[model samples]
Target: MLEIRNLDYRVEARPLFEGASARVSAGWKVGLIGRNGTGKSTLLRLIREEIAAPGKDSPIRLQNGARLGWVAQEVAPTDQTILDVVLEADAERHALMQEAETATDPDRIGDIHARLLDIDAWTAEARASEILMGLGFTTADLSRATREFSGGWRMRAAIAGALFAQPDLLLLDEPTNYLDLEGAAWLEGYLRRYPNTVLIVSHDREMLNRSVTHTMALEHRKLTITPGGYDDWLKLRAAKLAQLESQKSKQDKDRAHLQAFVDRFRAKASKARQAQSRIKMLEKMQEITVPIAERTLPFSFPEPETKLSPPLLEIEDAHLGYGPQAVILKNVRLRLDPDDRIAIIGTNGQGKTTLVKSIAERLPLLAGNRKVPKKVEIGYFSQDQLDELTEGDTVLEHVMRALPKDTPVAKQRAVAAQIGFSHEKVETKVEKLSGGEKVRLILGLIALAKPHILILDEPTSHLDIDSREALIYALNDFPGAVLLITHDVYLAEATADQLWLVKDGKVAPYAGDLADYRALVMSSDREKAGATKASADPAEDRRRNAQARDTAAPLKKKADAAEKSFEKANARIRTIDTELARSGLSPQKMTELSIERGKLEAEAAKAEEAWLMALEEYEAALKESAAS
Candidate 1:
C-alpha cells in the first residue's frame, strides 16, 4: 500500500507535480500512465524515496516493512553471468551462503546452514532459472556473460533479478519493451497470481488490460487514481470527458451570451439593469474545464501511387536467418496483397524480426525464392532506423531532407506539426529527443516517402498511449499493405486485418485473435504447473486443491477448441485439393488454386500442432485433478 498527500515536485524551477495526492491499497496492481515527459518516471522515483518532496510536510508513505523491487533500466556492462546476477537478488541468502562457506567453527557453520535452510537457499539457483526462462532466457543463456548481451536484453536480466527477489512491492517501468509476445504473456499470467502490490508503468495496452487491477494517471500536474483495468479506464474516461465537454460547451455559450448583452447595453440606462443582472449571473457561475486535451494531430500516410496489386510479395518455401549457416525460420510460404494488414506475433528470439527483414528484402532469404514486384516500394520503420537520423540533425531538418529540395519551408513546418513535433521541439537535435519523439520523426519521414507498403517492427514499443492512439489512427487510414512485427497487441488489433503467427520455426495464419492467444498461453502454463504438482499428498487441504483445479479447468476447453480447429482446417484442405483436381480448369486458375491449397495445408499443419499441444495440456490437467 502507498499514499501521497499534498505532493509537490519540480525540475529546475518547473513544476511537474503540484498539490497532487494518490492512494494505492495493499495488494493492488496499479498501472501508472501518462504521456511522455509528464513525470511518470519521476513520480516513481519520488515514491521510491530517491527524491524528496518540495517541503517536509508533503507526505509519501508505504506500508512499513514493504520491500520494494525495481530493476535498473540501465545496467552497466558487467562480466557476471546472467544466472549469477539473478541469484544474487536475495541479499540475505547470498550472505548466508558466504558465511557458511568461510566459517571454520562448528557452531558458527551450523548456525549459518540453519539460516540458509530457513530461507530455502538451496533452491535459489532453480528459482532464478525459472524467472529467467519465463523472461525468454534459454538454458544456454543462463551462463552467458551479461556484458555479451545488448542493452535491451541486459535489461531483461535486470527484470529477472527483480522477480527473483520476490519483494512485497514490484515496480516495473515499460518492462514489456524487451519482451516478445510470449514473454509478455508469461508476465501477464505471473501478475495474475502475484501475492503483492505491483505498480508497472507500461504502454502495452494488452498487458495493462490483463495484469493491472487499477490505473493511476499523472495528468494536469496531478496524480489521479482510477479503480479499473485499461478497458475500464477507457470507459470511465470517455464518460467523464463527455460530461465535462458538454458542461464546458454550455457554460461557454452562456458566458458568451452574457458578455454579448453586457457589451451591447452596458451604458444605456434602459437596458442597464438587465445587462448588469446577466453579468452577475455569469460571474457567479463556475468555470468548466474539459478533462482531456481538445487538440490531437491526425496523421496519415501519403497515398500510394500504385493500386490493386495482389501478391505484392511472395516467398516460396523460404528459409530465413542471418549469414549462411543458421536458419531461424524455415519453410516459409507467404503472399502479400495490396491491402493486407498482416501482424506478425511471437516470443522474443523467435525470428519475427528476421522474417520481417526477409520480406522487406533487407536481408537475403538463406534458401528458396522470393518474388517482389519491381514497381512496389516499401517504407520500413524499425528501431535501427533511428540511427539514420544523425545526432546533429533537428526534427525539422530530417523531415525536410526526406522531401524534395524545392519543398517550401512552410510545408516542412507543417509536416513537423503533423507528426506531433511542436515549434520548440522542431529545433531540438534528434539525439536529444525521447524514444517516442524519435519514432515520430522516423514515421514522419516514412510518411513523406509515399511508399506502397509499410513494414513496422514494434512501432509502438516506445510510444505513450496518446502517441499509440495517433499511430493507430494513421495506420487505419493508410491505403497500403502493412507488415507489422509488434508485441503491442492493442495497436496490432486496431491496425491489422490479419494475424501471422511466427512460432516454432514456422509462419502461419493463426486461427484466432489476440484474446484467444492469451487464453491459450495461460492454459498451457497452468497445465505445465499442474503436471509438476500432480503427485498430491493425501493430507493436502481441499481448498488449495480446489483453487488449482479451478485454474486448470480452462485447459480442457482450450483442447476442445483446438480439436475443432484441426477438424475444420483438415476439411478446408480436402476441399482445396478437390478444387485443384477439377478437370478443364484454366492454367492460371489451376495455378491460383494450387497456391490456395498450399495455404490451407499450412493452416492445417498449424492446427494439428495446436491440437497436440492442447491435448498434452488437457491430459496433464486431468492427471493433476485425479491425483488431487
Candidate 2:
C-alpha cells in the first residue's frame, strides 16, 4: 500500500532520515518503533503530505488512488453530536445520503440508495457507536454535543471517525496514550482485525505485539521491516546484531594481524615486497561499521533507611466517594505491604484512580479509616504531578530545591545524574524538556523523598520501551511497596507480582494474569459486536425498541441525578484550579488549597463513577429487557 525509496530528509541542519527506505504491503499492520525524538511522528506527517519530503526524487508514495487517514487533531468543539461527526466521516455514504435527499429523478434517487446499501450506510450509526465505545465513550455520549466533551474525549471521537471511515491506508501515532487499559485492549483487538493497511507509531509494547502484523524498526537513520510482531522482530534484530558483531570482530582481528605483519617485516628486505602488498590491501579494505547500540539509562529510587512494618498502608471498609449516596466503591479493603508489587487494572471510570488516590492518602475517605505508620512516607506520581513542576526552573534547580538547603552542590548534581540527566541537560529549563525527560525529572524528585511506598498512575505513558524496561528494573530493585496504575500491560506484567482489579465498584485481587485479562477484554468486545449485529432482525429491533422505552425511564432519572452531582463537584474543582493559578498566595494557603483540591478531585471522580455505573446499568437493563 505504501513504498519509500532513499528517503533523505532533514530538519534544519539535523538529519532525521538518510536514505531510509521501506515498503509496507497492503493489509499489513506495521508498528513504527524507535527511541523518543527519532521523528516517528514526522514520518507520519510526511506520509500524510502535510510536510514535504523536499525533492522531485522524494519516494514516499502510497499506492495509486489509495486514501490516507490520520487524526490531525482533536475534533473541534461544536454543536454536532459525536455519532453525527463519525457518521459523516464516510464521505461516500454522507454524499450519497445528501444526494438522495435532494435528487429529483426517481432513477437518480434509486442509484443513490443503491450506493448507500453497497456501503452499508444503514448500519453506519451502529458501526460508529461501536468504534466510540471501544475507545471508552458511552452510548449517551454519542448524543451529547462535541462541545460538552473534554479534549481527550474529543480526540477519541476523532479516532473513532478515522476508524469509521476505514481509509485504504491508516496512520496512527501513539493512539493509546489517552486510553485506559480496557480501551487499549479493545483497540488492540480492533486493529488486529482491521482490514486496511496501517502504519502506527506507538510506545505500547502490548499493542505492538498483539495488533500489528509487522514491526518496522526506525534506527540509524534507516527503516528495517520485519514480518511478525515485536517479539519476532526483537529476536531477528538480536540475531542480526550478533552477526554484525561477529563480522566486525573477525575483520578487526584480520586488520590487526596484517598491520602487525607490515610493521615487523617492512624494514626486512626479504619481506619488504610482502609488507607493501599487505599495506596496500589494508588501505583498500573497508571498515566494518557496526551500528552503535542505543543508550538506555536505568531508573533509580533510593532505598528507605528504615523498613516499615507489614501492611505499610491500609484502608479498611473504605467508602471512597462523595458521600453515602454517591459512593463509587464501598466496603473496600486494601493493603500495601513493604514488599508488595501491585498493579491496578480496570475499565475507565471504574474507580482505579479513586482507589489509588485513596491509597496515596490524596483522597479523604467518606466513611472509613486509613492506617499508616506515622513515620512512613508515600511518594505519589501521577500525570497531574507534572503540572506541579516549575516550568521556569532547570532540572538541576528542581532537584536542588527538593534537597536540604545545606546539602553539597556535588550531591545535588549526583542526584540529577542518577535520573539520566547529564550536566548539559541539568541546566535545560523544564519547559524545554520533552515528555519523557520530564517524567525522569519527576521520578528523580520522587526518589529524593526516600519514601516507604510509591503509588504511580499511568507512569509509562510518556516513556519509550527502553525507559519502560528501565522502570521495571528500578521498581524490582526498590525496597518499597509499589502500586502502579497503567495501560501498558508489558510494564504491569514485568513489575507487578500481584494484581488488583477494580470492577463493579469494588477493588479486589485479580485471579488471573495479564493474558487472562486480555482475553476477557477481547471476549467482551466480541460479545458487544455480536449484540450489535443481532439488531439487524426487524422483529428483534422492534422488540428491543419497545423494551428500551419501558426500562430506560427510571434508570435515566438515576443517571441524570448522578451526573448532576458529578458536574457540581467537577465545577468546584475547576474553580479551585482557577484560584490556585492566581498569584501571591501564602505557602500555608497554597498547601490548604492543594489539599482541598485533591479531596474535591476524589469527590468528582466518585460522582463520575456513580454516573457511569448508573448509565451502564440502564443500558444493561434495556438489553436484558429486550432479550426477555
Candidate 3:
C-alpha cells in the first residue's frame, strides 16, 4: 500500500536518508526501528505529505484512493463526549448516518441503510468503546465531556479515534509511550489482528517481536526490510555483517599481495608486463563498504557507599493516595531492602503509580506508618520530576543542585559526564534538550544522590532500544535496591527479580512471569466483553438514538466545511515549504514562495479557529439534547 523510491532527505548539511527505498504490501504490520535521531518521524511526515520529498523523482507514494491515518493532535477541550469524538473521526460514517436520518425517499433511505451496513455503522459505538476501553478508559468515561479529562487521557481518546477510523494505512509513532502494561498488551493483540496495513515506529522490543510481521531497519543512510520480527532481523543483520567483514578481510589480503608484487616486479624487465597487469587489476577492484559502528549512551547509577540494613524503607498497612478521602490502595505492606529489585505491574488507575509514589515518599500515607532510617537515601524518577526540572537552567545547574553545596565544581562536572553527557551537552539548557536528553539528565541528577533505593516510574518511555538495554545493565549492576513501574515488559523481565501486582485495592506478589500476566490480561478482556454483552439494553439504545437525532446538524455541517478549509490551507503550506527548500532558486522566486507560505499559515490558523468555534457550538447543542 506504500512505496518509497530513491528517497533522499537532508536536514541542512546532515543527511538523514540517502537512496533509501522500501515497499510495504497491504495488510502487513511493519515496525520501523533505528537509533534515536535516525529520522523515523521524519519519514512518517514525508508519507503524510506534511513535508515533501527533496525531489520529484524521490517520491513517497500510497495507492490511489487509499486512506491514510495517524493520531491527530488532541482536539480542543469541549463539552463533546468521548464517544462522540471517536464516532466523528469516521467522517464517512457520520455523513452517511446524518443523511440516513434526513432522507425521505424510499430508494434513498434504502441506499443509505445499505451503505451504513457496509461500513458496519450499527456497531460503530461498540467498536469505538472497545478501543477506548483497551486504551484505559472506563465505561463511565465514554459519556464524559472531553474537558473533564487530563491531557494524557485526552491523548488516549485521540488514539481511540484513530483506531476507530480504520484507515487503509495507519502510522503510529511510539504508541505505547502513554500506555500502562495492560494497555500496551491490549494494543499488541489489537495490532496483530488489525485488517489494514500498519507501520509503527517504536522501541518496545516485546511489541515489535509480537505485533509486527516485518521489521524495517534504518541504518547507514538506507532502509532494509526483513521478513519476521525484531529477533529475526537481529540474527539476519548479524550474519550479513559478519559475512561482509570476512569478505573485506579477504579483499584486503589480496590487495596487499598485489601491491607487494607490483613493487617488487615493476623494476624487473622480465615481470614489468605482469606488474602493469597487476596494477590494472588492483585499480579495477572495488572496495568493500564497512558499516559504521553505532554509538549508544551508557546509564550509570552509582552504588551507595554505605550499605543500608534490611527493610531500608518500609510502609506498614499504609493507605496510599492523595488524602484521607482519596485513598487508592489500602492495607499495603511493602518493604525495600538494600539489594531488592522489584517491578510493579497492573492496569492504569490500579494504583501502580500510587504505590510507587508512596514508596518513594512523594505521597503521604492516609493511615499507617512509614519508616526509613535517617541515613538512607532514595532516588526517584517520574514524569512529574521531569516537568519539575527548571527549564531555564542548564544541565550543569541541575546537577549542581543535586550535589552538596560544598562539593567541588569538577566533581559536579564529573558526575554529569558519568551519566553520558558531553561537555557541550552539559551546558545546554533544559528547554533545549530533547525528550531522551531530558530523561538522561534526570537520571544523572538521580545518580548524584547515590541513594540506597531507586524508585523509577516508566523510565524507558522516551528511551531508544539501545539506551533501554544500557539501563537494564545499569540497574542489574547497581548495588542498591530498585522498584520499577513500567510498561516495557522486556526491561522488567531483564531487571526485576520480583514481580508485584497492584490490583483490587491491594498490593501482592504475582507468582507468574510476564507471559502469564499477559494471559491474565487477555482473559480479563474476554470477561469484560461478556459483561458488556450481558448488560446491553434495547430501551436505553433507543433513547440515545432518539436524542442524537435532535443534535444540531447545521452546526456540524459548518464545522465540516471549516475543517476542509483548514486541511486545504495546511496542504498548501507544505507545498510552499517544499518549493522554498528547492536548490538554486532566484531571490525573487524565493521571496514569493516565502510570502505565500506566510499567507497560507495564517489562513490555516484562521480556519482552525473557525472549526473549533463551530465544533464547540455543535457540542453544546448535542450535550443539551442528550440531557433533555
Which candidate leads the pack in lDDT? 3
* Model 3 local distance difference test score: 0.84
Best by TM-score: 3
Error of 2 at 367 (Å): 1.1
lDDT of 1 by residue, 1-628 (tens): 7888888788997889888899988899999988888898888888787887777564888888888889866555687778888888878887887787788999998888888888788878767777787777654456555754557778888888888787888899898888877778788878878888999999888888888999988888998889878888889888989998898998889899889999999999999999999989988999888765745455679888767467788899998875343456889999988789988877566678778877888677788998887888888987766755654568889888887999999988987988789888899999899898888888878887788889999888778887789889888788888988877878888988788888777999998988887677657743453233222442343344345446556764676687688788768767766776788889998888778866766776666556544544443343344344
Model 2: residues >4 Å from true position, as ranges? Answer: 267-273, 323-325, 529-628
Q: Write the per-residue lDDT of candidate 3 for residues 288-318, one digit (tens) a residue.
A: 9879789888888888878777989888888
Task: In model 3, state the lDDT of residue 351.
Answer: 77
Worst 10 residues of 1 by lDDT: 529-538
Full candidate order by lDDT, most accurate first:
3, 2, 1
RMSD of candidates 1 onward, in order: 17.1, 6.5, 10.5
- Which whole-number lDDT from 0 to 100 does residue 183 have in model 3? 88
Error of 1 at 208 (Å): 1.5
- Which residue pairs clash within candidate 2? none
In angstroms, what RMSD does candidate 3 have relative to the true structure?
10.5
lDDT of 2 by residue, 148-184 (tens): 5656778988899999999999999988888888888
Model 2: weakest 10-residue lDDT segment is 529-538
- Model 3 misses residue 593 by how many Å? 41
